[model samples]
Target: MTRYYRALRLQMQPCGISNHAAAWVTTSRLRLTLPTSTSTPPRLQACRNSRSISSIALNRTNPPESASTRSKDGRQQQNGTCAIRPANREFSTPSKVGRIYDPKMAKLWADTPMSLISETGYKERSDIPPGHFAITAAQNMAHLHNVIIRGFNASYNQCLAVKPDTVDASDFLFYNQGLYKSIKSHHDVEEDITFPSLVKLTGVQDIMDKNIQEHKDFDHGLELFRTFVFETDPKSYDGKKLQEIMDIMFPILHTHLVGEIGTLLDLAKYDSKKLEEWWADTSKKARGDLDVFQDAPLMLGCIDSTFRLDGDPRPFPPIPAPIKYLSKYVLEWRYSGRWRFNPCDTFGKPRPLAFPNPGGSKL
Candidate 1:
């Protein structure tokens, strides 16, 4: 009698993954084993995809129950809706965005609306859940890409402007530095504060390992972009080099941002009360470590530019009203030269486009 041995495999593409890595602890590794005659090949074919956005390995051992996060009745609750249902484990964003290489065109944002993961009724609900927050966060992350892309397009246009010499490269470099640091702060918060809390709250082991791996995947390009920004003299800014880096970095970022959001539905398992508490605590602590005076101006500049009233998809993190007034009125004037390229005023209101729109359309 002949016997078969089936194996699982994980394949990573040769290009686009990053070089400099944060601490990546691989809890599991894919095995390539010989299969028996009875084993079918279809199973393997079903698993392969570009995004690597599959759900956590469900086969892992689930711990014994601690308490009923559920109501007296066993049904789950989600986003103020009663009798919550299990997320269809197989649910995935309909498109395979990882296959695309350009962030500007990937259209991943089109697929990751907050409503897809949480109850749509939350839009009307006076209160929203953590899962809802994650969905909005995902939308905001995708929007950040557009801000970066717009900045790049503006630079490209400047290079082609009727009189290129009249344009100052140093001023642009200051703008780029501010933009880069803002994104860096956002990601730093995720890796340091948010992911760990989610892992504990969700009660899923190694749940965030893949997210960390994805960070490692794109962080190399980001590091290169950073070096260029800080090392290159603003007086002799290299627009060509800047464009080249943006093209390389955007697609990798798109894949990670959209893919990470797709998994947030899993957080819906925790009760809304628990979810809200975790987010509130985690968010408050996330940025507490940064130097406020030196760092916040640039970060606020970038965040404010991409996200503004009625036009933006989500609200800004709850900054106190007094601080908002001070940041806009008191602190931002120091950086006025660099901020001239920004799409908003110091108070986070939309401003006229500083660079000419090549397609001659509204931003």
Candidate 2:
């Protein structure tokens, strides 16, 4: 019985469907042998589901077509991958181009728009010294410094003229910021280019070096003033604070201007070749450190005359005022053709004019 049951189980194992429909035997009497491939015909195994059966038949008969479809689907999936998307890629080209094309200058002169102040004739030319180019550069530096100084003085006076309590804090801050920005920018250009070049040209490295140091000192004072204006309470206009700010600022400015003027006058004697060489060397060293020179006006208006009014009465008369007045009058007379002879010339020995005080104050 056991042997018969084992044989029945072997017969039921998945082999195939037979063509004969009535080849059955009772389980108690059955005996079966597995068919060898050479002796048995090929058969179809039964699938559990219709879809799986269809897929199996299709795969067997059309392998190349199915493989082609799979390859196409794979390619689309790869293309849709987030890592391959356009938006995911970094924009490196613009930055690279920018670095390549951008001008590496501290200031550009051409970008500064210039307007003609007058259409009249220029001032008379003077004989330049051997190192005239260096001297000219120094003069330009001095002129620019004076221009900024005058601008600061004017701005400060304007601020002072207004009643502090009535003035808008925002307006005052804005004004101070503008003045500071302008002055600081100008000074930076000088320290980075103008003064350094002048030093090289004149070969007065020591003086130039000292000037650079002075710039640091000047900046220190400026920082303090900036802090006082911006960081401190706007309503705090105590006498001590005001005095402190003035005390730190005025002396530094006065000394800087005086020293710069002296240096400029000394530089005026250098030759063109020396100046050119100095410029070349300094420019090479500076590389793109300097900003592009914007042709902004050195000054907006004339300097204040009030600073000169601060001293004791002198024994000698003030010479510059009369000279300035006479010079203008003489030029006007010449232009108008109202003079009979050369008003500038004299027949007697030229003696200094005794300028009598019109106001009878006993001196």
Candidate 3:
């Protein structure tokens, strides 16, 4: 049967004409036989003259009276409406509803004016201590925290649209590694270098203990993130599952950063030397431990988890107090060349801090 079919196909081919011309002849024959009552004679003539065999074949395959052609004609039948077919196989039409603005809502905030609060009322009255170096260090650490947080938030939110499974495996690995290194190094520096140096500079040993405990809390959150990355399939991330992980970790991170900032502020008030020592140690650790490649993965994991509330999309909460402090601190460190010491005067304009005063002012 196959042999007979092949012979019949060979016999169907034109004797001297090429396959292209044969196809044109076959299509033209088909076009001549199509019913002419439905379409205008001009369209039929135009189809006959179109040189491309494929065009004629298409016209014959989707005859003018077919459902699809009728649908297209129906759309054209509508006055002043353009039928747009998308590449994704969806059809769309222009909206007729005009934009409506709520005047009451618009007017509510329109009459209210904004003004910068005066710095005069909020100045710290403490005398500048002789060991200016320590004061600067505390300020620098504050800055570093700010930068890291901002980088984390920006990178994380950018990746939300990325399917967890679809994320580059290399990037995921890098992000996790960077996160571990950054957290571990920060903890190590506080325990071994920053805390000890602060003790020597300020003669206050209790502060060091408190800082160590804070580091331990942060380490707990880091441990949770590490476990999630290792256990969860990146590609199959369930929003709820990711959110559960985030809920457990963000508060810990927030608390740890806020505690550190509060401690630094206290140090700044008393012994600037200790603050300077702490900043130097932390910077040294951060530079050595943080891996840029790993940041993205860590951030993705963190954000995916944090933003997963009730498995529904919601506005990301305001930047945590610790992150804000860290951002400001890092910005200062970048702008000012001093890695170990940042003078209070350099914190020129009063800015928001995680720690708010009784009167609602940021410390």
Candidate 4:
């Protein structure tokens, strides 16, 4: 074994992940096959017959694409990393194979016509870290996903509900950047802060690996979605084309959005005080990561539109009073030409809903 192999072994053993195959699985790029039972950690093993330095497993770099994966038209899809699955896995869901393309169905069920349900008996509970914080984070992330999806829907409906024609490229660009930065920025911080903190506290290194993989599974989709918006000329922009890309991207994104809540709630067994402390610290990191000019307006606006200060037990980080004023009036105005496409108002209230959510009357 080379010195690098010995170093790798020394680094991982103390992390509680170097027991066997689990160690190899955590450090390597192999797809994890987690057991149905949560109690048992997955088994893995590493071999150290290093003929060369490159032969040793290292932190994964984005893998290269294969010739066999080209579209029949002889062009590569913008992000060629996503592999489509054949209809064969016994345990896989429909989304595992490919998207079920039915705009009507998606709108009908998931994004139903808005019928205002009052907070008649909604009781907010106090949950300590791990579970409480986890659920809250999941809920907020899901809310952000909903806001983005609805914004896209509204933009599409405005331009092409009845027919497709010229779209406002400026609007599309703004929306694309807003949505992209919002989701990506949130995720980057969580990966940087929460996952590592949780691991340190619990001494279970692989606990958050599943969530990391979920983020990975959707990367190509986001890339394709972004590329389609940026690369296509506004004059040539087709609503159907946008719909198609969204259909390709959203199923995986949606699953990740909601799936993470349950995964995090499972961590309640850990130390609550430490988890809570970590949540606050991680939140600061997330807030600090937000760029005042580019990302602040979209993120703050979306949060304002989705999360309620009055009802939500945990208030999201507040924009300091001075920055809040400047961002709301000056900075947001600079970049928010496309907020007309947003489903909710800057304050998080429903502004007549949007395209996907049938604009229903209030009681």
Query: For this target, which candidate reaches the highest TM-score against the unseen true structure?
Result: 4
Q: Clashes in model 4: which pairs?
A: 20-44, 21-44, 21-45, 22-44, 304-348, 305-348
lDDT of 1 at 251: 68
Tell how far residue 183 is off in model 4, in angstroms: 2.1
lDDT of 2 by residue, 197-244 (tens): 666555667767766777788787788767766664446433245335
Number of the candidate with higher TM-score, 2 or 3: 3
Q: What lDDT would each prediction earn against the true structure?
A: 0.44, 0.35, 0.35, 0.45
Clashes of each: 2, 14, 22, 6
List the candidate 2 regions with Cα displacement exceeding 4 Å.
Answer: 1-131, 161-167, 199-205, 232-243, 273-363
Candidate 2 Cα lDDT to native? 0.35
lDDT (10s digit) by residue, model 1, range 148-223: 4444443433322212233345666666665566557667777777788888888787887887888788788888
Task: Give the distance in Å from residue 94's predicted Cα in candidate 1 to where it truly belongs.
Answer: 25
lDDT of 3 by residue, 188-263 (tens): 6566655676677678778668767766666666776667556667666543343354456556665665456546
Error of 4 at 210 (Å): 1.7
Candidate 4 stretches with Cα past 4 Å from truth are: 1-167, 286-291, 304-325, 353-363
Highest-lDDT candidate: 4
Tell me the alpha-carbon RMSD of every candidate: 26.5, 42.1, 26.4, 22.4
